[model samples]
Structures are given as C-alpha cells and as structure tokens.
Target: MISDDIGKRILCLSFNQTNTCLAVGSTKGFRIIRLEDSKTIIKRDEDSQSNFPGGFSLVIPVFSTPLICLVGSSSNARYPFNTVYFWDDYKTSSEAEIHFRFEVKNALVRRDRIVIILEKITYVYVLNNLQALASIETISNEKGVGAISYDKDIFVLVSLSKEPGHLRMENFYTNEVKSGQVHENPITYVAIDFIGSIGASASAQGTIIRVFDCAKLEVLYELRRGSRPAEISSIAFSPNQNYLVVTSNKSTVHAWKLEKKEKSYTSMISRYLPNYFQYSRSLGKLSLKTEIDLTCPYSNITGPKACFFTENEFFIACLDGNIHKCSIHPVSGEISIAQSLQYFGLSSVSVVERGRTWNNIE
Candidate 1:
C-alpha cells in the first residue's frame, strides 16, 4: 500500500528556458506555475480524453512559450510511453505527438529541433514539421541522462556509456561531434550552460562533478560535491553561466563558483601532485527541512528539483508539495531560505485572487 501511494506522486520537474516558470509532472497531470509569485498560470487536471490520465512523468516547456512536451507514466497511462506529446497550453490540448519503436526515456525541445531519446538511440527532428534529421546511437541510457543548450545555435551532449565515463557532444548546426572521457565511473547526470560555452557532468560515484569547455571538450574544473556518494537529483547552471548549483538525495543543495581559467596553480606541489588534490569545493550549501529521510536507501521520495530563479536566488521544489525560495550571499557563500509555500495540491484560487489583472502575455 505504501509503495502504491508513493508511485502516484510527482515524477519529475523542469524549468523553462527563460526560467520564469516551472513545469511539474505529477501522477495526475502537470502544472505551470509562475516563479515570481508562485501563481498557477496554467493547471490541467487529469482528464479521461485528450490528457495524461495516468500522470506525467516529464514535462518540458519550450522557452517560456505556451508549447510544452510531455511524457506519460503509470500503470494505467492512457498515452503511450513510447510517444512524446506536444501540448499547447494556450489551446489546452495536445497539438501533435511523435512515436518511436522503443520506450522513450527522455525528450527535449528547442526552438528549431526536438529530441526523442530511447534506450540506445536518440532521434532529432525539425520542430515545425517533425522531419527526421538525425539518428545518433548511444550507450545504454536507461535514465535518458542528457542536456541541450537553449540557444539559436545549440550544443547537445549525451552519456556515451554506463561505465568508464565518456560523453559525446554534437552541434546540430555545424554537425561537429566532440567526445571526452569525463570520469572513471558511469556518468549519472549532465548539464550544459546557456550558450553552450561550458558543460558539467556528474558520475555515478557522485563525489565529483567535472566541468568542461564544450568547444574544446577539455576539463576545466573538477568540483567536489562531497567525499561520500549520493544520488544526484539535479544539476543546473545559472543564467549567466558563471555559477552552478547541484542537488542530491542527501537533502542538501550546494552551489559552486565556476572559473573558466585553465590550470594556473603555480605552487611547487602542483607540478608533482596529481590532479585529484586540486578539486574545487562548493561555495555554500543549504539543507532542506523535510520529513522524508533523504539518506535512506529505501526512501520513496522523489527528492527535490532546483533551478536558479535569479543570479543570487533559486527555488527548490519537493515532491512533498512544497516550494522553497532561497538566496545565497555572493561574498560569504551563506545560503538562507527566504520563504516556503505549500503550492502543490493546493487549489489555484487559494494562492492568487482571481480578480487580479494579469497582463496579456504573448
């Protein structure tokens, strides 16, 4: 009974390209909430027809537009698991869908292209008309761990294998592929910066995250999240790409300062000591207050997903139905919680007044 209940909770969360809103995929449906005031801009409850009746496993918004991509998951899911639905919130219906032979593990969208990731292959298509452009083969990506930069000229990277960490990055415009051996263990999570200048990858060991220069595919920095191993929930770069924040099942979020400078440590020991000794640590970290035991191996909690709402402030959304607005001191590296609101499962009418005038957003 406990397992059944937990399976009906939130599956995942994502922030749009502009970072102004959040798209939550839950067991019943998805919600688009404005981050500034935590208002439910669009809420679609479960519907018997033309909706994700079982629930949404993943929901990604395309550049703060009304168009969104959805993947459904559940035992009773009405939508096929092998398909990706293009939902238009402005129309409040699914505009179109694309299907694959194998079950889709992940999906991503940009202005010009749409990516559907299967276990061993990823297909790229033209967004406007769903024209097949490329089919790239990859190592077993059951988790569908990959990221794409939200720029006119974009960079997309995917984990190459489950062991002996390797990543493959490709620029669709130039059709140039860059490969790099990132870590000794399997890559668990990957993230790219705004304009594809830099990218970060975390290994299954979860102790260290390596940042790379996307153009050269060279290691820029090896950031140490901690000495112990933990499951990484999310990895995100700030809008300006100067900072990175990471969240783990440990119920802690850590922020790190990134420097693009190359190896410049000029100390005497630097020449003799191996690169492991120079791992950069986080600037600050914030622990979440939750009833779920994040460290437990059997805990069914989905953990928290986070993104930078601003350069100095970010929001953490937990599957337990809470949103935490937090801020970090630029100089001191101190993380503080600004406010907490129970937005999940709450009626939209309760948070914002219906009479309030909202600007007609295009």
Candidate 2:
C-alpha cells in the first residue's frame, strides 16, 4: 500500500503478503482503518526525537502462525539507529510494543521471516514468537536496499547509491549466491509478479523500467519511458501479472502490458494544466492547443499517487484529497474512470487487503 497526500509532503505506505502487514511509521502516528466496515481500529504515535523525527521508511508484513509487521525508520531520527522493529499486531495494549529490535538499514518481510539490508552489512533475521530465531550475514557492501521480492527459495535485493544500480539474489536458506547484475541508474522500486518468477525495477531517473527473471537474476526486457526526468516514486504489478503501473513526480499514470502479443502500454494524462495560455507558450514552436486538447476533462490536481486493486482496477490519489478509481483493459490498452471518492483528513493514501485488522496502542 502507498499513501500520499495532496501536499506531496508525506507518503505512508505498507506492504503485506499472505497473513502479514508491513506499515510505514508516520510522524503524525499510525492509523489502521478496516476495509470492510471503514472503521478506525488502531492509532499509535510513532516514536520521534528532536534531531531526527521518527517515521517509518517502509513496512513489510510477514506471514507466520502469529502475524508480524516489519518496520524500518528513517536513519536521520534518534528513535533508533538503522533499526528494524518486529511488531505483533495481535497485542492488546496501547503501546503495541516492539517484539525485537535489530540494527539494520532496511528490512523486508518474506513468506517465512524477514530480511534486513544494511549499508555496509547485510543480514537476514528469521523470527519465532517475535524473537530473532536466526541471523545470517551476507558477504557484500550494500549501501541501500530499495525493494525486495522472493520466489521459490530465491530472494532478490535491489541496491542503490551514487554509483550504478545492483541486483543480487541469494539462497541463504540453501546457501547460494547468484551473480550481481549492474545498471547505470539508481533503482527506485522493484516488484515481483504473483508467480514470483518474473519481476521489474524502476529507476531513480524514471526513464527506465527493467524486467528480469527472478530465478536467473537476469534482465529479460527493458522499457524506456523518457518523458519525465524525476525519480519514479512507486511501481506495482497488476494482480494477474499482465500489466505494470508506475507513478512519478510528473503526476501522470502509465500502464504497461506484459504479454508479448499485446506488448504495449498507455499513458493516461488524468490532469490537465490550469493555465492553458501559459502552458501553450512554454511549448516554444509547438502549438499547444492543436497538439493537445487544452479543454479536456482532466484533473486539476497534481502529485498523483496510484496502486492496483486488481490487475484491471487501479486507484489514483490526488493532492486535492480525492481518489479516482479506473478500470484498465489489458488487451485494448484503454482506461476508464469508474469511481471517485473524497476522503477528508487523508494526507496520504495506501490500500491493503480489505479484511486485515489492527489494534490501537492507546
């Protein structure tokens, strides 16, 4: 789940699979709303300090007998130094409490446990009863990990820095290290498909989207989207693994088809410029009105964030506190708006499986 507000100042998102939920810590606090009844269940203040305000950089849920949420906090804060908070959401107290804390740069939840990626040191921690059951340190100097996905027994790590991007896969469970593949740009986001055999990566430049094989750790295809120079903020795989949705600072949403026969994607310009005359003249020699419809029925909001409910259904969050749901046709490459809702006091928006539950700390 990806959460963002109309102001572009905050983004709260969580990632979960099977029975676990990963929630990003927020400065304002964490709130869990039930999808079935739309009721607020949990709200807790994320620990913070004067130097580094505390908030979750990322949240990943792990599937086990008892559910666990893997939480990572920003490095700048004083709450803890590059730590991973192991949380059991089933607890009843207001202080949900941290089951375990490990000094790690980032963490991701897998089917059986959690993987913590550090700047210079990499470690994988398996949990049992909210305790670190086993820890494995990998041999690599990884600066940062942006995204992670697992398939079969293999785990893929996407590392980024000022240097070129690197992708590494390892089977610590069985003890195997796949060769590290490198790219020229920094990796922004990564997602593995439902089958876990295929995966994709978006770059900080927002110009390249690379598709790779999780089993082989190989780049099979690369799609170059050259319109925006900003970083790719979010990327998601459609539920059925037929299309990929990507969003960025440009406030535009793009859907790319994965099928070879219908290998194409469409760009939906949901929002149009408010000042047509100014935008027209900025185009230099090109006639803006003739080149693009200035009066099209588009959104006035900017900084749009998006996610998928299914492969064919998606929702986009606007800066104006509105969420627009659209239905996408994979074969036809068409997008149609299905519904819109205005959520009050929602600065950022993210979606998870509808029936998950949360208990408040206070």
Root-mean-square deviation of Cα positions for candidate 2 versus the true structure, in angstroms: 12.0
> Once model 1 is optimally superposed onto the true structure by TM-score, how far is the C-alpha of residue 353 displaced, in angstroms?
36
lDDT of 2 by residue, 61-155 (tens): 45332344434344224345355555545762222324234444456666655656665445555544334543434333332344555454655
What TM-score does prediction 2 earn? 0.63
Q: Against the correct fold, how does model 1 do in TM-score?
A: 0.86
Name the lDDT value of residue 348 in candidate 2: 27
After TM-score superposition, what is the CA distance of residue 28 in candidate 2 from its true location, in Å?
A: 2.3
Off by over 4 Å in 2: 1-11, 18-24, 34-39, 45-55, 62-78, 92-105, 129-146, 150-163, 172-176, 180-182, 261-306, 316-323, 342-362
Residue pairs in candidate 1 whose N, alpha carbon or C atoms collide under 3 angstroms: none
Candidate 1 runs further than 4 Å off: 1-8, 46-51, 155-163, 260-266, 274-276, 292-301, 346-362
Q: Which candidate leads in TM-score?
A: 1
